[model samples]
Target: MTLTIEELRAGVPKHSRKMITQNVVEVLNQLSSDHGEDFAEHYKQNLMSMSTVLKSGTYNMKDYMNAVKFSAFRLMDHSDVDSYMLAFPERYQRLMLKYADYGDEQSIRADKISSFVTAYKKNEIVAKVTEQALIPSRILNAPMFQTALNIQMSIAMSSRSDQVRSQAAESVMKYTMSPEVQKIELEVGVKGQDEIMALRTEMHRLASQQQGTIMSGTNTSLEIAEQVILHEIEDHDDIDISGELG
Candidate 1:
């Protein structure tokens, strides 16, 4: 039986239903044909599950749909590059063209596959895939991390330039060592001059009131000072600081 768009998009929210474009339906049907009905159904469920993370408002509809397409391609067994290219010429061409400026053909292909794999591994869909495949998530990401470390090691050991090698070695140490404590600096400022002045006036009034009540005696030095401050503030009542305070 062929999978229909309605069936593939069954659990998606109504408002976001249109995001499952025709291209997405075509990919899902292809999965059903090539991987079997059960695998394709599971893939659809995984894609739907990603909507939970998508609700964060970070991703738009296009990004969500692209992630769905990218994840679908990654899940498929595309071990033979030539055969996979033959099967999906457009996808192959697009990826090749996108990474054309990076390096040679082989490197470009590696970079393309690595990008897709990285996206698949980082996305929330991997959490669902991990649960179903019963593989540790760390294990899935292990190779990529190792690849990064290998590149850094190569640069640190073989680079002839002292500055570059020193920088690479420092990066390796920074990554492998315990991370340094990050200092977060926050800046706070009153938005308006009037507000700042009003706040200062309010603080002064409170301080004066508190100083007045601090002494037990009715006519102590502190009491007299407080009374004088209160009288001065009262004399300036015509300035109308209340509106700014509020």
Candidate 2:
């Protein structure tokens, strides 16, 4: 039932109001099937309209800009986003080749990262990661864990680790220290950062003595698809009580 303003506007032209309502009903049913009744009700209550008050050009940049500003604000002032690309050049190159249809680089990068993070926040990421766990090769090879690997490598080798950590700690020292954990916290404001930081610290503290191989490279298309499958499976389980498995 929920959609972006642009999506809502697009749907309005293609479908009638009643059709929309029915469609929303079906969607809510499906959501309920996956997320439980409580979540379904919550989502229905929060269903949003796509209409917006625009100032001149179309396509409201409010939310998009907010995300960008948030990322920029939390990120090191002089930190190079390109560094991620440099560290994992092949992954970026492959993405450029695969996503050629999307001409905007920044848009592509933002979409890619946001999609991953959003799914992670929704608990979809865990399913996906678990699914990856199912893939025997990924668990054994390590390279299959591209996104996580990249983040791990970036943090392990970051020149601004101390600087980044200091700023991040100021924003959230009580949480944890893992980048994956910290990145999400930065989105929810300062307090969230602390919580994530504390989580990160705990993660490392527990793993400190363990010398397991860490994923340390960029993500690949196959890896992305794998994660998506995992997300779907997790979502499927979350909404369907009968679908739960051991």
Candidate 3:
């Protein structure tokens, strides 16, 4: 299922909610430095204020604003942004369906593991680490670490709390299994797991160094942020348009 703008509004806080004009403008203004104040300001003043900008209605207030937010976020880390966008009600409903598919995969994996475990319990001496392939082969193959990292990175940036950051790291280790599976993933054209992990660690280190830095905004520590975001774009080949764009 796909998400619509109206549903996105439902997920955002009420106080944070403003007229369509304000919210869209503010998001554009926030992105001004990267995209150019002139580009954002021009779109805000001319195109966005129009009555026929969205299909939902003639005076498309909320829905138009939602579309803008969706499109704008897509130009950032699109995959990550898409995941967050799924929090909207329409997307959330669709997510429930996807969850069923995941449940099926888990059930199959679990059944295989149960058989393996039962066999192992009967003859412990004969069991090898290879015998427990179902768990790591199935569940661990998912992008569990990437998902946790996304949550933790958002929390760390927004909260600026070390405790939250630590919890995020712990959550990654908890959900993601051993480095053994990471090797398999890398071998399957997933790119460098070690590099990604190191990249996250170093980004965290730089963030910690800049005690007064804000999250969800421009990275003021130029050199480090440039390196990190560039590498991120390279690995993901997604929405990040740092050096490659300009």
Using lDDT as the yardstick, the better of models 1 and 2 is 1
| Candidate 3 off by > 4 Å | 1-126, 136-141, 173-186, 192-195, 203-246
Top-scoring candidate (lDDT):
1
With candidate 1 superimposed using the best TM-score fit, by how many Å does residue 33's alpha carbon deviate from the native? 3.7
lDDT for each residue of candidate 3 in 161-184, tens digit (9 for 90 to 100): 445544554565455445553212
Per-residue lDDT, model 1, residue 12, is: 71
Candidate 2 has what TM-score? Answer: 0.19
lDDT of 2 at 81: 38
TM agreement with the true structure for every prediction: 0.34, 0.19, 0.27
Writing each residue's lDDT as its tens digit, candidate 2 over 1-246 gives: 343334433433232332344444454466566646665544332232111112212323333222222232223232233533532346567776777788688787776644534443244322222232223332244333433433443342222333332333333323223444211111122234454344455435423212121123344323322331111111111111111111
Regions of candidate 2 where Cα sits further than 4 Å from its true position: 1-21, 48-246
Query: Which of the numbered candidates is closest to the native, going by highest TM-score?
Result: 1
